[model samples]
Target: MFLHSRHLSRRVAIASATALLTGGAAAGAAWATTAAAAPAGPRTCTVSDLYVSMGRKEGAAGSLYWPIRFTNTGTTGCALRGYPGVSVLDAAQHRMGAAATRTGGAVSTVTLAPAHSASAVIRTTNGPVGGPCQATGTYLRVYPPASRTAVLVPAGWKVCSGTFRVAPVTR
Candidate 1:
């Protein structure tokens, strides 16, 4: 009876140790997965870190579309979310009209590494709806997402429509 009891105790001890080891391994695996899935926080792209430019222009149905590109010029990775503030500027650097309206789009965070770029689509009507264009614009003033400073991009053609719409920044 004594020998039998000892064998039973040994079996229970082995089982307990096995369970503990299995549970620890599972916990460790869960922690590893969570750590791997966690995203690294990136800084917001500042006006100095970004270079704004216009891409090829396209027109359809009396509306013009231009791709506004923001290139990350800094050495570190940065993020841009939502739409950029856009406005037409005359040669004297005065705002020609109200800021561009934000069009509906999926506003997701875009991480840009050094030298990488993201683009937003700007749509403007061919002409003013109510009256003739107030003034010819020589440049397009662009403000980075969540930034107050503006970047001036040369406009090859004058913008007739005072109102414009801008899509969200995308990869």
Candidate 2:
């Protein structure tokens, strides 16, 4: 017996559809596997992996700027994105005033290799700017982004509540 032309065309159509579906599924699986096997970027930098320090003081227009440096002391590379938490502390290890607010800047992920460094700028005034000096700071407490732990860098400044601002970390 011989098949009709209509029946033969329908069979071919079905076979073609099946082949396309199978090939598409296999291609999708292969793509997924390749993507999964790709290596990931560096992890976020933690306080334990960094050595924080205060850079030289700079002043302009009655505002004080300090470049807070974060050096990667770990064995591997890490990343630091966004702003670092900054606050003034008195001699007794107590918070002197309100925490430093985040200032405007181009925020991007800063990848630091081992022994490399990233920095952020903390701005305040020597005496007072927008408000009265709330307390005198003997040490500046710094918290790296996304980290709960904080490190203290020796600093002598008059701190005003809601007056301190910090820029984002950069290379």
Candidate 3:
């Protein structure tokens, strides 16, 4: 799926990333209990209900793994299942390469309470996987499962191949 930018400000990006890393402490207990035992949530999470952010990059097997977090910012719990639609975007807010392909993982619904989060890992190559390099990505456009709306998260990468893959969303 192609994601179109909404031209959000830098302040919004910082705030969203902050929420992913530090703002969900109080809700951890609820998140743990529900995510482990609860059934699928009553409603699916929408883009407006999530604050998306990218965690620190880790390198392995000649590829960089980015942990993309989706924190629930709404008042109620919502569900996230399967893989998120991910694509690299340039500074000009245009698609930089092919969208991510689902790699592997058990598909399970994660019910996130307000302030809690679920995550997916995106794997990108440091060297060309399929062809020569193109423009480096400045941001990622991520669509939560089952939603058309896209959330933009700041990123810096030059992915040359269509080999970019994303693991399924998990608790």
Candidate 4:
């Protein structure tokens, strides 16, 4: 979903504050759990310029072949996490992340370079939602690292995001 620049700013404010409030002490918990279960990533660095590409329809409901592109654009590689987040803003649907409900979308393992990019597809459907999916704009905002704690959202420090559109798979 395309968020207006102003609205995006507000979303940032809400999301940041929420993260801060929830993550303050939780950050330590996450570290404790992750330290033993995982190894250090590509490196220790700040994440920035997170964004998603325009979404594609994937032929709608029952038969979906929709594609979404992703890129890191961060100073260092970051985990794409469990599933590529599929954010849907439907007055009728009323869902947060459509992919959360749908089972086909999968986030691939690829390291996004400063400008490098990749595309992935929802190969099959488990519980696909039908849509007259009228995408207003092609892009979704990126949620910055849950661990980025700061008194202020700094300059040149952009939260990640992507547009919503359909296209051939790119890498």
Give lDDT per model, in order.
0.82, 0.83, 0.81, 0.40
User: What tens-digit string does per-residue lDDT give for candidate 1 at 122-147?
Assistant: 88777775556656678999998999
Superposed model 2: Cα runs more than 4 Å off: 1-22, 25-29, 160-162
Better of 2 and 4 by lDDT: 2
| Candidates, ranked, TM-score | 2, 3, 1, 4
Q: Compared with the true structure, what per-residue lDDT tens digits does model 4 show for residues 85-152?
A: 33343334343333222343443344456665555444333132332333332233332223242112
Better of 1 and 2 by TM-score: 2
> Which RMSD does model 1 reach against the true structure?
12.3
Task: State the weakest 10-residue window (summed lDDT) of model 4.
Answer: 151-160
Judged by TM-score, which candidate is best?
Answer: 2
lDDT of 4: 0.40
Candidate 4 error regions (>4 Å): 1-39, 43-47, 55-62, 91-99, 102-108, 120-171
Off by over 4 Å in 3: 1-40
lDDT of 2 by residue, 1-171 (tens): 146545655555565566588875455544444455445689999999999998898888878788999999999999999999988888988997688899876899999999999999988776655677776689989999989899998988666535789999998
lDDT of 1: 0.82
What C-alpha lDDT, on a 0 to 100 scale, does residue 62 get in candidate 1?
Answer: 83
| Candidates ranked by lDDT | 2, 1, 3, 4
The TM-score obtained by model 4 is 0.36
